[model samples]
Target: MPNPSSTSSPYPLPEEIRNLLADVETFVADTLRGENLSKKAKEKRESLIKKIKDVKSIYLQDFQDKGDTEDGEEYDDPFAGPPDTVSLASERYDKDDEAHSEGNQFPPIAAQDLPFVLKAGYLEKRRKDHSFLGFEWQKRWCALSKTVFYYYGSDKDKQQKGEFSIDGYNVRMNNTLRKDGKKDCCFEISAPDKRIYQFTAASPKDAEEWVQQLNFVLQDMGSDVIPEDDDERGELYDDVDHPLPTSSPPASSQPIDDEIYEELPEEEEDNVPAQVEEQRKMNQD
Candidate 1:
């Protein structure tokens, strides 16, 4: 083991840690050469190797720079060396912090930036009720976050009524009957859990936009678990029952005849029965 007393840097990585890092590098390299690796897997391994090399380079540079310092004297460092040297070293040599200190090429991510709103609006959610109607559409304020769909009683409501993950859910435009028996512009989020959430948008366009955004999010999440084709969807996601089609078919499309019926002409007094006429004459007399 190299003498710690000979090292000028106050926080130098231990020999065991250096050996472990080396072993990690070797393992990562071997794994990278393996066949049948996905593109994402290969990219991640390459990134790991780059990070290891960069960390090793930093320690070598630090040692060389502080070599001329007084023998057996520790250099001043901002961090107090903790017993867990690996944690301390990681903190002291954090590349992200280093980049920020030297002037970041990219600006720091803001809280809003981390989870930008995917979609937000007022939607009527079908909730169960004990009223004459088994279910009713209650308007809800909704927004899509990185991991889940959040819904509140109103836009300003801090307390969310409910939320569900988008992992294995599928979104599609589905029309359903309103209380007045008219179909509403709606969509549904169905999952393998057999729990279907239905929402009514203000308009067909709004419903379509919601579906598109949610579908895009599911696809981006890399959850190919939900199949795209409607025919194949039943095997993966719960099939929601849509009461109506997007639009009602025109009456002209029906098989009924186009012929118009003419009205029959009324008979004159000559058509009256003789017994009925005689009875009416005697009553009048």
Candidate 2:
């Protein structure tokens, strides 16, 4: 049986694809915000994300179908650096912090505290620093603990390469599946300062469970941190109230029922009187 927690996106979204989707979203939002574009005109034009759903769908399916058998069950990246030591000296992300590359300054919780790990798996992540010429997706081991989430190069070394305080963070799933995702398993994380990061899961079901755990942590902590939207979700996908359109199911080919439109026949006056006389005689009897 397939692992219940495994998601459809064994591979992460490519850099080019992520950038394209982000650009389309930016264009549509900018157009809507500008005084130049009328409501009628916006409605008339094709939706930005809807136009590319098919492309993303095809790419995602094709990628998954490729015959490659590397069991992800064994994800052990050799942990580099010294003994685990996390410092929460700064509330905001410190770009200069040599210990944390992602700039999140949350102090690392004891590994033992993560007794109830919501998820543990291998996923390819877009590098914090990327190159255009090369499709730069870095591989890392990801896990969600009770209070925090951690990603690093290895399970043995236990060096927390990157970490996120799940509580109070705004998480959003993609509107459509891409070559690396299914049922919108892709998602992006936004920090309070508006920095965004994207990740893809192995399948749609896995994504839902993951998001639920993230929200649960926030509630458990009673955190008041309000996530800032990045000039409108610039990390390829997230929550937009008038949300990006998702890929809907195909319409059925069956014809409409004719009985619904058919009219009832009128009652004849002669038959109606006879029926009334019979009813009166029966009542008298």
- Candidates in order have lDDT scores of 0.56, 0.49
Per-residue CA lDDT of candidate 2, range 1-285, in tens?
233234234466574564454344333432233335676767644454344343344344432332122212223211232110011101011123323454546665444344678777765444454433222333456788766677654454335557766655777776442443233767666678744656667676766676666766666577476544566556545454357688765544222333333322233545788999999999999
Error of 2 at 194 (Å): 3.7
At residue 124, candidate 1 shows an lDDT of 69
Model 1 lDDT, residue 173, Cα: 79
TM for every model, in the order presented, reads: 0.36, 0.38
Q: Which stretches of candidate 1 lie over 4 Å from their true place?
A: 1-114, 177-184, 223-285
Model 1 clashing residue pairs (backbone): none
Task: Spell out the clash pairs found in candidate 2.
Answer: 7-202, 7-203, 8-202, 8-203, 9-202, 59-179, 60-178, 60-179, 77-154
Name the best candidate (by lDDT): 1
lDDT over C-alpha atoms for residue 214 of model 2: 73
List model 1 lDDT by residue over 1-285, tens digit each: 344344334567666666466445544653235356799988988788667555654466443433433222222221233112222222223223334332332333322333667788888676532122112444567888765776654565534546667778888877654433224578898877445778888888888999988988888788556436766776455436544457766887553433222212224344557769899999999
